[model samples]
Target: MSSFENVTVLTKANVYFDGKVTSRTVQFADGTKKTLGILLPGEYEFGTDVKEIMEIQAGELNVLLPGSTEWITISGQGEFTVPANAKFKLEVKTVSDYICSYIAE
Candidate 1:
């Protein structure tokens, strides 16, 4: 995973699924933002307002991406994308750490 040295934090954090997932937003020097988070072992469905790239930093995730029937397994150091205004489901077999980058539409 890449480090965000000298980045600015958004000053607010996000919690989802009753705290099963939580993230803090940070902005790069170029004005790009990303959320760094962790997910406990469980199933979760997420919706995106913009295109998102989810990069796994630790543990494993089984993901059912939009427009797909098969669940793809992504381990630590892997990544996946979800389109704008779309949804995807994830099944975590172990505690998972991730970084999500949002792409402007």
Candidate 2:
């Protein structure tokens, strides 16, 4: 991972857990392959397991889950749990980072 300004640049795509971005390949329903990237702190609405991917273009933030009725905030670290085909939003708390999050859906 690389950091420029306040955003961390992702070297390889992987699964996001807690505060760690691991190296792995995520498959979507449409069969698109994506290598994960930097996860800027915030809220993300991953519509569901089928929604495939999310590209967060900001840093330090709050995220709204796709199908849920709640707003979650992340300071230094956070995790994203996506069900199949969920749609959501991200509320950036600090400067934003450009994270390319992709899924198979």
Candidate 3:
């Protein structure tokens, strides 16, 4: 639903959660990197070394952020940020498309 023209693609990255999740890495001209991916219905945990902003492009997700017991719902076009060296858990209710931006710490 979005366009990222004139950007440099770094490489292809695949994350297999029993073939439930996968992603590709993209690099922009400004040294910013992002992962455009999809998540099948499942529960997953992810760790981050740098700050990251995850933008939901389609479908929905229930996320338990770092140090939180409450699960926050992120619908299509919604976003959430995770701090450096933090981790987050996600419950994917449906097939979800996402764009995860990596930020410099």
Predicted structure with the largest TM-score when compared to the true one: 1
Q: Tens-digit lDDT track for model 2 on 6-94?
A: 33434555455454333444444454544445544454433444534444443466777765678876665555655565576766666
| Ranking of models by lDDT | 1, 3, 2
Per-residue accuracy of model 1 over 1-105 as CA lDDT, tens digit each:
458899998777799988889899988888788999989999999999999999999988899999999999987779999999999999998889999999997
Give me candidate 1's TM-score against the actual structure.
0.92
Model 3 Cα lDDT, one tens digit per residue, 1-105 = 458988987565777887799998888888888889999999999999999999998988899999999999987768999999999999999899999999996
lDDT of each: 0.91, 0.51, 0.89
In angstroms, what RMSD does candidate 1 have relative to the true structure?
1.4
Candidate 3, TM-score vs. the true structure? 0.91
lDDT of 3 at 41: 93
